[model samples]
Structure formats: structure tokens, C-alpha cells
Target chain A: MNWTLLLEQTLNGFQFGILLFLLAAGLTLIFGIMDLINLAHGSLYMMGAYFAATLTKWTGSFLLGAILAIPACMAFGMIVEMIAIRTLYTRNHLDQVLATFGLILFFNEFVRLIWGPIGLDIPLPEVLNGSVELFLGIRYPAFRLVIIAVGILVAFLLYLLVSRTKLGMLIRAGASNRQMISALGVNINFLYTIVFGLGAALAGLAGLMAGPIMTVEIGMGEGILIITLVVIVIGGVGSIKGAFVAALLVGLIDTLGRSFLPDILGLFFSNDVADTAAPAISSMLIYLLMALILAIKPQGLFPPRGA
Target chain B: MKGTPRIIFIVILMLGLGVVPLLADYFDEPFYTVMFSRMLILSIGAVSLNLILGFGGMVSFGHAVYLGIGSYMVGIGTMHAVEDGIEWMANGFLQITLAIVFSALTGLVIGAISLRTRGVYFIMITLAFSQMLYFVAVGNERYGGDDGLSLYMRSDFNGLIDITYDNSLYYLNFVILLLSLYLSHRLINSRFGMVIRGAKSNEQRMRAIGFPVFRYQLVAFVIAGTICGIAGVLSANQTEFVNPSVMHWTRSGDLIIMTVLGGLGTLFGPVIGAVAFLFLEEFLSGITEYWQLYFGPMLVLVVIFARGGIDGMLVGLDKWWSRNSTVKNEEID
Candidate 1:
């Protein structure tokens, strides 16, 4: 195994993990604060990517497209909450699952109708397209570095927003005890909508950044959605910090496992068998990790005290 | 007025299903066999889901995993049997039995772990486990991976039953469906079913009454998984293939839709649901390429307008019809 290849895979894992953090952060917040199970959260991610792709084509600026898409996704998310999800907040989890599942079907089909079934590509801006030299003569794409920088920047901003503001305090209060927040006259409805919109924006940001690296398509949101769920599960469902750490951990383990497991296994098994088994085993690593985490701490690593 | 009318309605419905093939034959059509066979297989799956979701109050979002496991069992068993030319030990019945047992074991393990949490946690955990299975299926190349596994021939029934012919298969499925319906009815009314239902109504109350609610739910989950496994086996045989798609979250969603569309907590709800759902799917798909454009909105409408589902609507209609007739009868008397 080449050291350079290993290093590159490690970076790739970190990048993937950061993207997962963006998605999971929003999901956990909405779930914790609103007590809503929005399975269609993935649809918001899909919409963001699609919106960015379309806007970039029209405006000829990737940055502007992303800027426009974030607000669009937030608006869409708020509308969905008001029209459908608001009623569901008072219902049981089963109703939430069923209704949101319907939303998924609707959104997937709607995207297909509008964008067609084929995938679209979002080219990286020319200024950020080239590779930058890293350690040991290894070159990495500048675009990927930008993605990492953006992820960190967002994480910092999120940290400030959640820890510093009065809204943040309310959010924390709401997540811990919904009744108490309402009793305190927090405009719980407006708070839920804002939280939902914020969650959608985060998911949208993940989608916009992911569009350049991964294929942009109607069903793209679903693959990431599952991983984000895994991240949230491992991270303790209500904590942004936990989501960040778990996302990075999951990303690194998954990427490195897939990249190196076969090579390692080749020492004991035939190349063909090793190749076949590696992928399956690697895909299962995160789940095994999740199970291990839950086994150790059933409430999750950073479960909110009241939760 | 009570049992007789219900029995008559059921008998008429069954007879109507039984005579469909004859009616189709008269019209020189052969599609009824396929439709009925599909209905029978899906009904088995829906009924299995109803046992847990309706009676036990465990809304598993990954119930389709059992179907995948059951189908894969058939594919793997047949692959080995053909390679070794094993006759006495490995056959269709044995394969199906193994599939049911394996799926039940999986259910037991998953239920044990997931049942530790309640509500949203249970849904998410079950979904996560199924997703893991899906990923494993997609990545494992030996089992055909993403392209899925195809059988060279349908499973042999060893002359104990001939399922090669469409009509024979239809009849066989009918027999199994009827048996399942009967078994489910019996199971629901049993003392065990009572405990499960009571647990669903108020778990805390049941616990206060000294019932071990978790064990009862786990048992229900296992039984439900095993029944769905049988459906999966039949599905694989019908399609002559098995794939990871069987365990997809969408498939599980479909099962939930069928259960809700029929009527929650009703023994025969899932059966009606499966039949109506598949029929609607077939009809709608024929009308447009994007049939779900209509189907999705319709589901939303159903949730908004008819929360109790089509069965509930029918019961309401029955009540209205009876009340109106009673007034007229009183005037005549």
C-alpha cells in the first residue's frame, strides 16, 4: 500500500464525514426541537442541489447559485412544515412516519417530473478547479479543500449561533423540555418553523457542496440520508457537537475500510474472494460501530439530559 | 344480523375470487391467474405486518428485510442444490422452512435490540438494520450483488405439489393465503393475542397487571417476520429471482401503506389493503408513466379525509344503510 494513496483516502473520508455532519446537524435539531420525524428531509437536500444546478446554469456563478439555493430550500422547508408537518407534531410517530414517507414519494416523483430521471453535473468554478500540492508530492483538488474549509466555517458559525444567541437558548430550552418553552411564551410555532428552516438550509448547503463531487440527481439525497441517520444515531440524536464528531468518524472509517480492507485481506485470502468480501464488510463497519455505541450507551453518547 | 351477514359477505367475496379464473376463461383471458397469485403473495406480507403494527403497536419500518431474507434463502439454497445435485436433503420445502426460521431469528435479534427503545427510536433502529442488510446485499458480489440473483428454475415441490402451471400455483397460493387468514384469525382471538392487544392499548397498564409486555411483543414480531418470510419465498418463486430491492425501505413503506389503507387493528384489514393497493397500482401505472404523481396526492387526501381508511368508510356506509332501512321497516310494520 502506498502511503500517498492512504493519505488521500483519509482526506476523502474526512471530507465525506464533514458533509455528513452538515446533514445530520439539521436533522437532529429539527427532530429534537420539534419532535418531528421528517423523512422528507432528504428531499430538501435534493431540491438544493437541483436549485443550485439550475441557478448556476442561468447566472454563470456557482457561488451565487448556492446562495440563492439555500434560501429557496429554507422557504420550501418552512412551507412543508406549516402545511403538513405542523399538524403531525401532535400526532404519534407512526403518523409522522407514514405522512413523511408519502412526502418522500411525492418529492421524488416531482423531482423526476421536473428534472427528468437523468443526473446533472455541477462543474467546479475555474478558480477552484485545479489541484494543490500537499505533503510528499501529493496533489489534492483545490475544490475539495474549499469544501473542507466551508464545512469548518459553517461548523464554527453554527457553534456561535447555538451557544451565543437568545434563540439558541430557546432552542436548547425547547429541545430539553418542549412544554416549558411553550409555557415561557417562546412563540413555539415560529420557533419550530425557524428551526425547520435552519435544518433545511444546512441540508441544502451539504447538497450544494456535494453536487460538485457526487452526481446530482433526484435520488441522490437518499444515499446520504441513510448515512446521516447513522451519524445522528452515533452522535447522540440531539447534539450538534456529537453529530460533527460522529460524522467525521463514520466517514473516515467507511472510506478507509473500503479503500484498504481488500488489500489487507489479500494477505490471507485469494484476490477475487477478498475483493468481493471487502466491500460488504466495509459497508457494515459503521453499523457495527453504531451497534457497539448503543450497546455501551443506550441513550447515545451525548443525549440531552432531559431527552 | 351479526355473524351470518359477516360470514355471507366473506363467503361471497371468496367465491368471487374463486370464480375469477372461470370468468377470465370465458373471456379468453389468462391474466386473472397472475393477478390473483400476486394478490395472494402480497396479502400474506400485509397480514404479517398487521400482526405487529396493528395488534402489537410495533411499527417496524424495516419489515421488508424479512422478505429479502426469505427470497435470498431460496436463491442461495437453489444455487447450492443445483451445484451439488442434492436431492434428499435440499428441496423447496426445506429451503422455505429454513428461510422462515432464519428470518424469525433475525427478527428476534433485531426486535431484542430495537425494542429497548420506543417510538421514533424503534422506527429508526429497524430502518438502520434493514439499510445495513441492503448495503451488505449490494456489496456482496457472490450473491449477484446489485444485479440480483436469478433462478435457472423454480423451486421443485418434489411432486407433493405441482406449482409449474400458473393455475396450480394460483391455487397453491390461495390455499396458503386461506390458511394464513385462518391462522391469523385464531391467533388474534387467543389469550396470547389478548395480551398483545392489551399491551398495544396501554403498555403501562399491562405492566401494572404483571404482564411481561416486551416478551409478548418480541414473540409477535418473530411470528410476523416468519409469516412475511413465507410471503417472500412465494414472491421469489413467482418472479423466479431474488434481489436486495425486496428489502428496500420503499417496499417497507408500501407494506405500511397497505396496512393503513385497509384499516389498522382489523384482522382482515391487511388483506383488503393489499388487494386494493396492488389493483390501484396496476390501474394507475397503466394510465401514466408517473402514476405516483397521482398516487401520492391521493394518499395525502386519504390521510386528511378518511383517517380510518376504506374499511372504515365501508363500515360507516353500512351503519347509514342499516339506520335508513330500520326507519322504513318501522313505518311498514
Candidate 2:
């Protein structure tokens, strides 16, 4: 067993987990507070990446492009909310799912229309392009490390906003009983939009970060969106803390399972059998984990209070 | 009087589908026969899905997984027959039976766990399970894996009917569609179906009234999956190939669209919805390369404005027709 390889994969898993958390946090927040299932959340992530890629090209600086893309994504999300999602709040989950499915189709085609069939590439700035040594003889990409750092910083800031602020109190109240909050003369509609925007911004950040790593393309959000949804479901639909924990768990399990399952299977079985089964089993690992979790604790690892 | 338009619409749709092959021959346009065959096969899937989604209110977003399963059964069966010299594996009846059994078992496992969760959780869980199956299919290298297996020949029904002929295949799909419709009609009105529908409207009330809602839902889920497997078999034959992409979540979304576009909780709506939805898709794609841009927003508008869909529109037309006839009769009297 190579310790360095294991260590490197673990760091990769952690980085991937952080990215999942960024997407899951906003998804959980919007779902928790608004009682809305926004399948188009992933589309916002795609938009963020597109915004960053295009803006970076214009500004000639990755930092400024990323900073500007957040607001652009927020504004796009708010517009979508006001026009399309607001009508869905009063409807059933099936309706929400179908309507948002439509939004996904629209967004994918919309991207294709504007950006053409090909994907856009976000170039890493010179400062973040190279690898840096972390410990003795171990080096990692500076950009990935930056993603981990930014994700942690954002998660910490989010924790403060949710736990230590008045708006956070209102958000908590809204999640528990939006009727009471509205009855208390709070502008619940405004709050809903703000939370939605905040969620969108978070998704945008995750997307922009993903751009340099993955191709900025149409339908890119969907593959990751499924993973994010799995993370949120495993964590507990409306719990931020749950999302964080579950994201890391899923990321590690998926990454590690793919890398190591074949070797482990080889010890017990023929090389041919192990090679054939590992990819299938490893790919199924997360979903199998999800099913097991749902079986044991259907409400997820951390059910929100009063949910 | 209210049912008049819907009845008329169903009759016309059935008649139209029944003659699709003959019409195709008359016009010398073989494409319509092929297109409608695909539509009818998928309508079977949509109708099966409507049983669980529309009546039972269990949104199994991974419904397409069964289609892939059914396809694989035929695809793998034929592959074994040809390569491994297992000739009996190519029998259509045996292949269909295996597809049903496998999909039913898959549905049972998926439903038992997913039905434990309600609402959006159910949706997400089902989606995840289907994805699991999709990945499994992709990883299976022996049966062409990700590229999928191409059938050298369609399923042999022991010379009962030759599906090699386009018309024969079309009629086969048509007969199956009617059988499924009949099955749905019987199942929906049956006592068991009442339990499923009742549970959908109000699960707690049904539970309080002594109905085991979860069991009823699970049964319906399995039944729907089995019927969809049949569709998959036909699909594999029609296209001569089966791939993992058939089980993709987007394909499931397409099924949901067909069901909803036709109308929910209606006997003939899904069939009608299949025709309308496919026609619109065919029509729109004919006009532009980016049909989804238009189609996506159109779907949103349908959900927003046309609550009941095309079937609902027919019902409204029926009401208006009856009202005008009644006024004329009153004046005559």
C-alpha cells in the first residue's frame, strides 16, 4: 500500500467534499427556509461558471471575474425566483419537480445558444497555477488548495450568519413556521428572495471554483447536482451541519471506493472478476450508501427540528 | 356529457394508431410507422408511470431504470444466444418473462426503501437508485457496457408473428398499448387501486381508515415497473440496441412530461399525452435546431396555465359543447 497515494487521494476527496458542501449548503438553506425544491439550483451553478469564464476573459483577472460572477448569479437567481419559482411555492412537489425540470432544459439550451456547442475553459492565474509543497515531499495544486481554503472560509462565514445574526434568526423562524414570521409583520417575501439570492451566490461560487477544474459547459451542473442532492439527502434535507458532514462522507466514500475497491476485491477474487466488478460496485457505492442511510434513518443523519 | 370529448378523443387516437402502418404504406412514408412505433412503445411506459405517479402519487423519478432493465434482458439474452450458443435465450416469451421478473424485483427493492420516505425524499431516493443501476449497466463490459449491445435480430416469438416487418412491429406495439390501457383501466377502478389513490390524497386518513398505504404503494410501484419493462423490450427491438442512456434521469423526466401533458388521474390521458408531447417535439424540432429552448418554457407554461393539460382542454371543450346543445334544446322546447 502506498501511503503517499492514499494521502493524495484523501486530500482530493476533501477538496471534492468542500465543493459539494458549497452547493449543498445553499440547496439545503433554500429548501429548508422556503419549503421549495429548486431543481434549477444546479443551473445557477452552471451560470456562475459561465459568468466567471466570460467575465474572466473580459477582465483579464481571475479574482475580479469570480468576485463579479457572484452578484451576477445572485441577480439571475432572483429573477428566476420572482418569475418562475414564486408560482411554484403554492404547488405540490411533483409540480415543483416538473417545473424545475423544465427550467433545467431551458437553462441548458440557453447556455448552448449563447456559448455554442463547445465548452469554455477558465485559465488559472499564474499565481494559482502551480503546485505547492504542503508537507515533507508531498505537493498539491495551489488552485485546489485555494478551493479548500475558500470553501472553509465561506462555510465559517455562513455558520456565523446563520447562528449569530438577526437575519439568521428570521431564517430559523421561517424554517420552523413561516406563517408566524409573516404574521409578525416581517416581509417574508423579501426574506425569501434574499435567502434565494444568498443560496444562488453560494452555488455560483462553487461553480466558478469548478470551472478551472472541469470544463465550463452546458449541462455540467446536472451531474454534480445529483451528487449535491445525494449529499443534502444523506445529511438531512434542511440541516447545514448535516450537509457539511454528509458531503465529506460521500466525497471520501466515492473517491476512495473508486480508487481502492478493485485492489481490495483482487485479494479475494480473480483479477478478471475483480476488474469487472470494481467499477460497477464502486460507482454504486454512494447510492448504496444513500439507500442504507434512508433505510436506517429515512429523515437523514440530521433531521431539522419540527420538519 | 363531460366525458364525451375525452371518449371521442380516445377513440380517434386508438383508430389513428391502429392504422398508422397502413397509412404509412399508402403514403410510402416509412418514417411515420417507425416514429409512431417508438411513440406507442413509450406510451406504454408513460401509462405505467401514470399508474404510480398520477394515481398512486409516488413520483419515482428513476422510472426509466426499468426500461433499461427490460432492454438489457432482451439485449443480453440475444447476445448469449448468438455468442455462447445458448439458443433458448432468444425466445421472446422467456425474455419478456425474465424482464418482468427482474424489473418487478428491482421495483420491489427500490419501492420498499423509497416508499419509506415521503414527498421529495421519495423523488430523490428513486433517482439515486436508478442512477446506481445506470452506473452498473455502464460498468458491465461483457454486454457492450457503456456502448450498449446491438441486437442482430429482434426477439423471436417462436413464429407466432414476424416483427421483422415494420407493420407487424407497429401492430405489436399497438396491441400492447391497448392491453396496458385495459390493465390500467381495470387496476385504477379496482378496490386495490382505490386504496392507492386514497393514500395519495391523504395517507394518514387512509391509514386511520385501516388501509396499509405503504404496501399498496409498493405493489403499484412494482406493477408499474413491470409494465415499463415490457416497453423496454419493445424499445430494444424497435431500435435494435439498448444502452445505459435509456435509464438516464432526463429520460425519466420525458416520461413524466408525457403523463402530465396528457392529464393526471385520467384513463386515456397518458396515451393522449404521449401523442401530443411527441407530436409537439417532432413538430418543433422540425422548425429549429434548439427546440428545447422553446419546449422547456412551453412545459413551464403548460404547468402554470393549463393545469390539466391536453386532456383537461378536451374536457373543457366537452363542457362547452354540451352547454351550447342544451341551450338549443331549451329554445326548441
Candidate 3:
């Protein structure tokens, strides 16, 4: 009911949106560049969190744990690509889906075996654990702010990498036309492995950052996986810029809708009914947004050229 | 036309299924009935998937959503019949008819939007929509929310047929399954089936030949949904419970697996697949808690070595055996 509370919630939603971008960016890149539907990408995110949690426990430093987990995830990604993913490149989408889905099941059970079913807590470093005062008397978690800052910084770096770097050029070219890139004398197979590995690392970074705020559990990856799919679908698959915009939009709509929908509906319905209806409607907000976007633009907002 | 082999195979499979209770007298009747009913339900689901996936070449990851919708229809109808004294129609037959219609309508709307895209986008979109429906069902408190709803009694058959008894329910499911198989067989051999198959084989050629591929695919999708809807009705009666889990993406994956493992693009592949899959689950789960560790690798091996599936493998073996027998006879002569 309070305006400031509503404002704070919107900011919270934006922060969540930025986090989604970090995950979706990597997913869209791999999906776009390789034309592979990697359902196991979310597993990478889950692995990142678990790795960070265990490392943080060992090293007694959040920053050092995150730094170590990034490369570890990259290495893990390369191993997966070599052992399982390379064979999938020649198979049809259905096989890829089935194989990756099997990977998801395996990874979830693997995590359960290693970490047990109990949710693990990853505490923020003592220095950044408290709340920070922002605007007029509004305060938010300092860690969340840090997440937003990192998200934006990553986004900027991604732009520079995709738009300015040689790897980015190959990635863009590969996404636009894989056959042509291969014919142009590039080692398409190695490029695909590197892209897949980078994608995993990015997902790992998102998971590492998300550990403090969300419950780090075995199935945490599945829920966010669905949302990341929605982001890519709406933003247009294979476009980093599209993912960045769509992620923020989805994050805001989901957060703000959950916060304000009950109050908005209270004008017509009783409080009890409103409360029950609000959450369901709010959860559906992103899907409804997706449907509307598809209806208007079936190819998404910014499909990669020639895609 | 060579129809004898297929007809003989179907008869043998049916006889085998029918004699299950009689042949295994030691097995509990209720257990056989439950397993048979589940097979029937899942076969209906897999067959519907084949309509689109095999014939239409649309690999939908959200096909289970129809089953969910069908189940919800029964749940909601029963809830209204119990609470509001509102009859869905005049009788049990009409109520089931309404359920099929409702499920088909949902399929139509979802398909109309989803069939616009191809490949991975199509799969993801269908999955996203189903997940959307799942969350909605989970949030609805009146219907028991996450715990799901229980039916107070089996749906009334208006004195035409009694479903409350186990034997009666088993026979009902059996009759329905046979009818579905027959109908699916006929549909797959018809002119419409030819168009759908053509689309599956080569959409570009179908389009080049002036066929509107999307419309045909959409229609196939709706028919598939309606068939699965019937299965949903039977499932509710068998279990006397309905939940959002019916529409979960994993269930969709299971349906796809059933179709592929039995044999894609074949008339009875789904039925074979469903039976094999459920039996495997029952047998494997008995051995260890980590059954999936074994099961997952098996699936990968099947995809790798037996890409054509069990049915395909059987056919290959038969061909090789017949050739060997002919060679042996010539040497004896």
C-alpha cells in the first residue's frame, strides 16, 4: 500500500532481472551459436553454486571461492562437451533433448549424492552483508546491489566481446551460418567447444552470485531454467542484446506483479480471494507476456540476422 | 496389399494382454487391472503424441499438457457436480464428451500459437505454456493446490455401465484401448494420414505440392489431444485422483521416450513403448533405489545402437532369420 515499499519492490525486481540476464545470456549464446538445445545448462548453474559453497567453506573467502569456481566450471563444461556433447552435434534435436534431459536427471542425482538433499546456505561476506541506504530513506541488501553491479558490468563486457573481439566475430558468424563458417577454414568443432565452455562459465558466474540470495538446492536450477527459456524466446534467440532487455523486463514484471497484484485486485475482490488469485496470476505474468510477444512477433523481438 | 503381418501382430499382442490375468493366476487381480489401466492410459497419450510427432513431424515437448487439461476437466467437473450440483451435461456420456471437447479446445489454442515456429523454439514454447498451466493449477487452492484433488466417487455411467467395480473398470479400459488402436490405425492409413506423413517426411516438398502444412499439423495436434483426453478420463477413474503432476515436462519426456523406444512413425509403436516402459520401470525399481542410474544409461544405449527401436530391431532379426532358413533349405536340396 505504501508508495516507497512499492518503489523498493520494483528495485528488487530489477535486481532479479539482472541476475536472470546473467544466466540467459550464456544460454542464448550456446543455443544460438551451436544450434544446440542444452537443457543441462541449468545444471552448470547448479554446479557453480555447489562448487562456490564448498570452496567458500574451505577457503574462508567468498571472492576467492567464486574466482576458483569459474575456471572449475569451465573445465567441467569442456569435459562434458568432449565426452557427451560432441556426439550430439550430428544428431537431431530430439536426440539432443533426450541426451541433455538425461544429463539433467544425472546431474540432479549427482548433486543429491554429493551435497545431500538439504538446502545449503551461502552467507554473504561480513563486509557486504548489511543493508545499504539508497534514495530517500529506502534501504536494500548490499549484496543484491553488488549482484546488480556485477550483472551490468558483465553485460557491458559481453557487448564488447561480441561486438569487438575476434571470438565474438566467429560466434556471430557461426550463429548466422555454421556451414559457411566451417567452409571459411575455421575449426568449427573447437569453436563450438569453446563457446559451450564459455556458456557454462557464464552460467556458473550467475549461480555463484545467486547463492547468497536464493536457496541453493538440488532442483533450484529447474525453476530458473524455465524462466531463462522465456527470456530467450521473448528477447529473440541468439542475440545477447535481446537477452539483456528481455531478462530485465521479465524480472521486473514478475517481481512487481507479485508485489502489487493483490492490492490492485483488492478493489474488486475480497482480501482472501485476492490473495489466492494474485500469486497464480502473478506467476503467469511472464508466460502471458511471452504469449503476447509471440502473437505479435513470432520470431521474437530481435532475432539474429539470417537466423 | 500386405496387411496380414500387421493384423496378426496386433491380434497376438491383444491376446497376450487379455490373457495376462488368466495366465498369471498367482498375480493379484487388482494389480493386473491397475497395470492394464495404466498401460491403456499411457498408450492413448503416446498414440496422440505419434499423431503429431510421427506423422506430422512436430516434436512437441508440451504434449502432456493435454493430459493435464483432460485430468483437470474431470476434476473440475466432479468438483462442480459435488459442490454446486451443476451437471456438466445431462449424463456421464455427455460429461466425458465435454471433457474431450474441453481438452481439444485447449490443444487448439496452444497449437495455433506454437505451430508458428519450428524445431527448438517450438519445443520450448510448448514446454513454457505447459509450465504456465502447471503453476496455475498449483496455485488454485480450491482444487487442493499442490496436494491435488480426490474424487469422492467414480463418474456415473447413467446405469449404462458400472465403473465402480474393478473388473468392470478393467474391461472398460480394455475396450477403449482397442477402439483407440483401431481408430488410430484407420486414421494413419487414410488420405489425411498420407498428407500428414508427407509433411513429416519433407515439409518443403509438401509445401511445394501446395499443401498448407501448418493447418494439417494443427489438426493432427488437436486429434492427438482429444485421444489423450479420453486417457485422462480413464486415468482419473482408475486412480480416483488428479494432480498438476500429470502435465509436468518430465511426463512429456516420458511420452516421447515411449514413442521412440517402441518405434517412431509406426502405428502401434506407442502402445508397445508404453507397455515396455512401464514394465521396465516396475522391474527395474524392484532391484535398487538408484534404478535411474541403470535406466539412464540404457536409454542412451538405445538411442545410440537401436535408433530404430525395439520394433525395428525385431523386424531386422526376422529378415535375417528368414534369409538364413532359405539358404539352409537350398544346401539340403
Please name the candidate that would achieve the greatest lDDT relative to the true structure: 2
Q: Which of candidates 1 and 2 is the stronger one according to TM-score?
A: 2
Task: List, for all models, the DockQ compared with the true complex.
Answer: 0.61, 0.86, 0.57
Q: State candidate 2's TM-score.
A: 0.98
Q: In candidate 2, what are the lDDT values of residues A1-307, reduced to their tens digit?
A: 9888898889888989999999999999999988888888999999999999999999999999999999999999899889988888888888888899999999999999999989999999999999999899799999999999999999999999999999999999999999999999999989999999999999999999999999999999999999999999999999999999999999899989989999999999999999999999999999999999999999999999998
Per-residue C-alpha lDDT of model 1 across residues A17-87, encoded as one tens digit per residue:
98999899999998888887778888889988999999889889999998999998899889988887787
Q: Where in model 2 is the C-alpha error above 4 Å?
A: B1-3
Model 2 alpha-carbon miss at residue B231, Å: 0.5
Error of 1 at B109 (Å): 1.8
- RMSD in Å for all candidates: 2.2, 1.2, 2.5
What overall lDDT goes with each candidate model? 0.85, 0.93, 0.84
Alpha-carbon runs more than 4 Å astray in model 1: A267-272, B1-12, B81-84, B87-90, B329-333
lDDT string for model 3 (A1-307, tens) is 6988887888899898998898899889988888778888899999999999999899999999999999999889989888888878778888878878778877887888779889898877887899889978788888988988998999999899989999999998998888999999999999988988888898999998888889889878888988999999999998888999999999999999999999999989999999999989999999999988987888889988876
Residue by residue across B240-304, what tens digits does model 1's lDDT show?
A: 88889989888998999999888777877787788888888899999988888878767766766
TM-score of chain A of each: 0.97, 0.99, 0.97
Q: How would you class the docking of model 2? A: high
